[model samples]
Target: MTKILIIGATGMTGKSLVAEALSNGFSVVANGRNKEKLNALKSEFSGIEVFNKDAFDLVKTDFEGIDVIIDAFATSPDQAYLQIDLAAHLIALLRNTTIRIGFILGAGSLYTDESKTQLTNDLIASDESTKPWRATPENQVYELEFLRHVKNVNWFGVSPGSNYIPGKKADNILVGNDVLLVNEQNVSVTTADTMAFKVIEEIKNNNHNQTRFTVANG
Candidate 1:
């Protein structure tokens, strides 16, 4: 069984990844800083081993015996820069190693049109209703920028659609390389479970190496 470690396992995406990995018979090592949430996760999935440590403090030794590490780390909009910092830290730690690193990024990094206009620009120009959370997506865009330069470690990035919500798996999914994905109804959304399933499939298949991809409900 491939030993997989998920950072931020207590978050919404992280929890789904944990469940998906376990259901597929992978050995899961869940990492989170909150002891209470970690306990809750352990209760929900009895078989998973837990790692209680801040992502910034994690050293290479902590990843021993792990084949893949999924960085699902998340933070509030005001502190969104931590996203890039964490990605850099992980890439530095795993440089030149065979361990595959997967980053859960936002769709802000995606191109919005054929001209390659990034979605982050439009997001920054959006209305006041989205004022507080804009930084989160902006920082996620920066995170992807950082990863694109990394050439040593095995890395792949997964970006959810415009509307990423908590829900069960979708009946159909559409994958894309860079531009934001939308369905015939002109809806751009992805359920947490659907994203988790696709990500796990990529990990198992080892395709899309050293690149990023986006997904949406079809």
Candidate 2:
């Protein structure tokens, strides 16, 4: 059985990922800052191991034997710097591990065209309206750069649709490479369940290695 560690397991997307991992028979180590929520999840899932610790406290030994690390943690809009700091710390902590790291990232970084500059400008502008969303691609770019230079650890980052939330599963998710994928309606969206499925699917397939991409329903 593959062992997986999930950071930010109390959030909506994180919760769905946990459920999907459990259903797939993977051993999960769920981490969250909230003690109550972590305890509740522990009580609810028979095989889940819960950790109520801050990101800074994570250690290499904590992730020993883990096959993958799913990073779903985020900071508030005003706390962008904090998000970068946390990501740096996480990268440093896992530097020695041979495990793969799968980051649950925001969609703001995806490109709609061939020119990389255009997509970057658009993503930065959209960040204003998407303030409530945490860890925009602007911040993740640096995280990705750090991860790329690291040795031994394989890293993959996935960005969900523009409006991802708790919704009915459509079972129709579109996958793209370094581009913003949208539906026929021109509005990209994904449910938590679909996003979770993608995460598990990547784990099983080992696709999109050392890169980031976006997902939506089309």
Candidate 3:
């Protein structure tokens, strides 16, 4: 079995990744900064190893036996740029080795159309109702851009659609490259369950090396 480590394993999407990867019989480790939540996950799920350490503090030894890493780490809007910082940090750690890296990318980076641009600019310009959370998507876009130039590490960035609801799997999942995917009702959404399944598939397949992909529910 492939030994995998998940960063931000206490978040909603991270929890789903743990559950789905366990169900698929992968050797999984949960990494997070919150011991309480990590303890709760341990109590709720069997066979999951937990590591309570800050992302910035992780050293190469921590990844000694890990085959793949899922970067599901999240931060507050005020500190959203940490997303890029963590990506850089992890990239630096895994620079020449074969250990693959995966990311739960932000939806704001998805292409709004064939114009070859993304929605982060418009989202940043939205009204004050979304005032407190704009920096997150802004920083996520920066993270993806930085990862695009990395040549040594095996990386994949999976971006969820417009409405990313962190819950059960949808009946069907739609996959796309760079573009915003829409269902028949023209709504763009991706559930945490579906995202987990797709990510684990990518981890196993190694089909999307150093590329960014998007997912939605149809």
Candidate 4:
């Protein structure tokens, strides 16, 4: 069985990924900063091993037997740069190794139209209400740019659609590369379980290795 390690396993996306991974019969190692949440996850999923520590504190030894590490790390808009920092840190740690790392990114990094206009640029031109969380997509774009230049590590990235809500899996899924995805109703949203399902499917197939892709509910 592949031993998958999930960083930030207590968050919405991370927790859903954990449940999906276990449901697929893979051994899971969950890492998170909150002790209480880690205990709760461990209790909820008796098959998982919990690592209670900051993601930055994780060392190579901790991943000795892990097959893949999925980075679902998230932070406040004010400190969104940590997303890039953490991606760099993980890339540096896994350089020249066989371990594959996956990242959950924002759709802002994706292009939205025929002119190839980035969603981040569109967000920047939107109303002031988006200002509070604008830094997140901006930094996530930076994170993907940084990952694109990395040649040694095995990395993959997945971006959710405009509305990333917390919920169970959707009945259908749409996958895209670079361009934003929308369903028949012209809705661009992805539930936590749908994202998790795509992620685990990617891990099993390795179809998007060394690249990034986007997903949406269909």
Residue-wise lDDT of candidate 2 within 1-218, one digit each (tens)? 99999999888878888999999999999999999999988888868999889877888778878888898887666666665677677777766567888887766666765565565426656666755644455676566666567665577888777677886556678988767778889887888888888889899998787787677776
lDDT for each residue of candidate 4 in 34-105, tens digit (9 for 90 to 100):
999999999999999999989998888988999999999999999999999999989989999999999999
C-alpha lDDT of residue 45 in model 4: 90
Evaluate model 2: give its lDDT. Answer: 0.78
Which residue ranges in model 4 land beyond 4 Å of their true spot?
none
Residue 22's lDDT in candidate 4: 99
- Model 2 bad stretches (over 4 Å): 114-117, 120-137
The clash count of every prediction, one per candidate, is 0, 0, 0, 0
Best by lDDT: 4
- In order, candidate lDDTs are 0.91, 0.78, 0.90, 0.92
TM-scores for every predicted model? 0.96, 0.88, 0.96, 0.97
Give the lDDT of residue 166 in candidate 3. 76
Ranking by lDDT: 4, 1, 3, 2
Better of 1 and 2 by TM-score: 1
Per-residue CA lDDT of model 3 for 8-58, tens digit only, reads: 988989999999999989999999999999999999887999999998999
The global Cα lDDT (0 to 1) of model 1 is: 0.91
Q: Locate the minimum summed-lDDT window of 10 residues in model 2.
A: 112-121
